[model samples]
Target: MIENIISALFFLAGISLSLYSVFMRYVMGGSQSWATEIFTMMLVWAIFIGFSTALRDDKHVSIDILYDRVGPGMKKVCELVTLIFGIAFSLFFIWTGIDMVSTAYAQEIRTIDAGFPIWINYLIMPIAGVLLFIRFVEKAYRFFLKKEIPTEKEAGSEWQL
Candidate 1:
């Protein structure tokens, strides 16, 4: 819930500011490059945060063509494979994100226009990585240890939430 609020704030601010930027550039015969930079940063934060939300909600994209045809054992196999890949991807994101944030901080980097700390923008990467890692592990526990699986509705979206 909190994550959703934060992400939405960033997203809405980005959209609003970008529109303002456009208005300033064309309508007002001026430019606000700083606004552009800020909005870009905000949108990036929103996107990375929302990425983890999708995973937690089981709304991440899955083909499931083969998975749909498989039996219970095969379905488990597919899920295990997906979870492994998801975990690996999350680890990679975490490592790369840390390296990016550290290097930017060490260099005292700032945005080209807005002058905001570059590391601040990079922070969401590792945060999202951790979120994804935790969610994937939780799914693994539910499926393997608890012997649970998502129902059809949980696995699929039939309508708006």
Candidate 2:
């Protein structure tokens, strides 16, 4: 619940900052490059932060064709397989992204736009990936416990309460 709130706040901050940047761009006749750069940075944070919510709610996109064709038992198996694969993939991303961030930090790289540090942008992929990875683990735990997995709607409602 607290994680959701934090993510929401991060997203709201991103939106607000982006809008302000856009307004400044239009109204000021010659916008500051940092405005756009900072806004872009905030966008990365927003995406990564919001990703956990998406995972928690099962709002991530996937093709349901096979899901529809499979029997109940098969569907469960498929879901388990997919979940395992997802965790592995996310772990790979997390590992690689962390390495990249560390490399960028050591190099002290900066983006061309507004001289923003490169590590900041690269950091999101892993942080978001880790959050998503955690969510996947949570799902797997639920599956093993024989608990009814919450659909996106139910997960969203769980937060409302």
Candidate 3:
């Protein structure tokens, strides 16, 4: 239920921000700096939040050639290795994101337009990092526990390309 809500929020926000960007470019007469800044921050938030959803559903992109050719046991080992790498990457992102947000907060920098606090934009990194971390843990747990895990098929089956 919580996952559903988060997914919906990310989806809506992403769509709205994207539309705003388009509007700023076409509809708005002048190139408003604030619009771009806000849109960029929202875009980052949307991407990270969407990535969290992807993590939950095991929808992250990967090269499946080796897995397809190799036997199931080898594939399992590869999966384990990939999981370890993913966890490490996520931890690194979290640490860096925290450091970045901290610096931004301490500096109290604001955007050139509208005097928007830059820290608000920087906040997205840490927030997304935490969300990604949680999603990775949840995925790891489900993988090991032999529980039913969400997949791209379940979460994004409607998408056709």
For residue 56, model 3's alpha carbon misses the true position, in angstroms, by 1.3
The per-model lDDT (C-alpha) reads 0.87, 0.82, 0.73
Q: Put the candidates in lDDT order, highest first.
A: 1, 2, 3
- Cα lDDT of model 3 by residue, 17-79, tens digit: 667767877897556556666666656666777777777766778778768999888977887
Q: After superposition, how far is residue 119 of candidate 1 from its true place, in Å?
A: 1.2
Highest-TM-score candidate: 1
Higher TM-score: candidate 1 or 2? 1
RMSD of each: 4.1, 2.5, 4.8
Instruction: List candidate 1 segments past 4 Å from native.
Output: 147-161
What is candidate 2's CA lDDT for residue 15?
80
TM-score of each: 0.87, 0.84, 0.78
Q: Write the per-residue lDDT of candidate 2 for residues 80-156, one digit (tens) a residue.
A: 99889989988997999999999999999998877888998899879888988998899899988989777767767
Which candidate number would show the highest lDDT if scored against the true structure?
1
lDDT of 1 by residue, 1-161 (tens): 57778999999999999999999999999999899888988999999999877877767787877788889888778878889998999999999999999999999999888889999989988999998898888888887786665554665564437
Task: Spell out the clash pairs found in candidate 2.
Answer: none
Clashing pairs in 1: none
Specify the poorest-scoring 10-residue window by lDDT in model 2.
Answer: 152-161
